[model samples]
Target: MIQATELRLGNYVNLNDGSEHDKIRQISGIEHKIVYTLIKGCRFAQVHQSFDRIYPIPLTEEIIIKCGFERSEYNDYRHPILFGTLTLYEGVAELHISDMYSVWVNNLHQLQNLYFALTGEELEVKI
Candidate 1:
């Protein structure tokens, strides 16, 4: 479950709807601690969801690639801002800068927050 307070307008998260795979949605709004997601409709409609059905996506190598980072020589995912490595040991994502300053993140939103804090920009992500 994700806290509405921790999410931003553009954060990507998975919304469970009893399907085999959770549906990824970009946050559109938050009110009364309830998250509103943009869903498919004419021009995309907004739907309010409970925290119980909303979850933070686990950070992974594939997700890193999806966010436009390329693989570095060290096999870590690299973008203009930093390089990241996700360990198989519990979906932990470690992002390190050129000076080797590292920050560990458990989900994609946390990574997004960290990136925005450092770069003052939102990630150009598709999902």
Candidate 2:
């Protein structure tokens, strides 16, 4: 987790549970009174207040696999797979950054988006 002052424009964050990921589209105000930009269609947007916790999504092989990318496809570097935001969360429940494929994400919502896109379900974790 990080502070509102540390938030970047494209940073991914889970303002709620670890399941729902929203991107920081914009930032305004000052210090603790920061406001976030929100557009239509996203799970969240346009916050007049700052959240107590904003969990940034760490892009890693474990996260990629958890989002559902196959490990077998990562063996090659030159012929790697490139996943767009639309198709990234489908197919498998395990993935990670690979030399062969480029996993693209500019915000936190991509994590939830991937999970939902692949599973046709809301992102959630078992307690």
Candidate 3:
């Protein structure tokens, strides 16, 4: 199975007006469709059940080194925003990352960095 950690933040291609500014809210099990929430509210959310499409963003080598995977420790939970993704379920939706292999490592690292950068915290996931 493809792991979610292999996906990078940049890998997400927003089908909404061809932008990558949206964040994933949930994923669906039956269809494996990814649900995203826009950083800026859009009227489309009211009319569409799912966005046009979701695509993967590529990861870079520098990101991999910076966002290396480490096992989660109990203390990590104290910082919810840092590791919120691990605990929360995206409601009825499930999160989806592309199955592509070329950018997996780089993407994972970038994703880690993005999370830390945005929340001002680090993530500790099993390597």
Residue-level error in angstroms, candidate 1, position 21:
2.7
Model 1, 1-127: lDDT tens digits are 9887789888999999678999888888888857888885435788788788899999877787787777765546677654444332258867765456777888888888888887889977755
Residues 1-127, model 2: lDDT tens digits: 5566555443345454244564433333335555454443555646544565454555444444444444544331110233432223332223333445545554334555554555566544211
Q: Candidate 3, residues 1-127: lDDT per residue as tens digits?
A: 2234433332333334345564332222212343433333443342122334443333332222233422244211123343332211222111122233112122333455556665766554322
C-alpha lDDT score of every prediction, in listed order? 0.77, 0.43, 0.33
**Positional deviation of 88 in candidate 2, in angstroms?**
17
Pairs of colliding residues, candidate 1:
none
Ten consecutive residues with minimal summed lDDT in candidate 1?
A: 81-90
Which candidate would rank higher by lDDT, 1 or 2?
1
Which parts of model 2 have CA positions greater than 4 angstroms off?
17-31, 37-45, 60-127
Q: Single out the weakest 10-residue window by summed lDDT for candidate 2.
A: 76-85
TM-score of 3: 0.25
Superior candidate under lDDT, 1 versus 3 = 1
lDDT score, candidate 3, position 68: 46
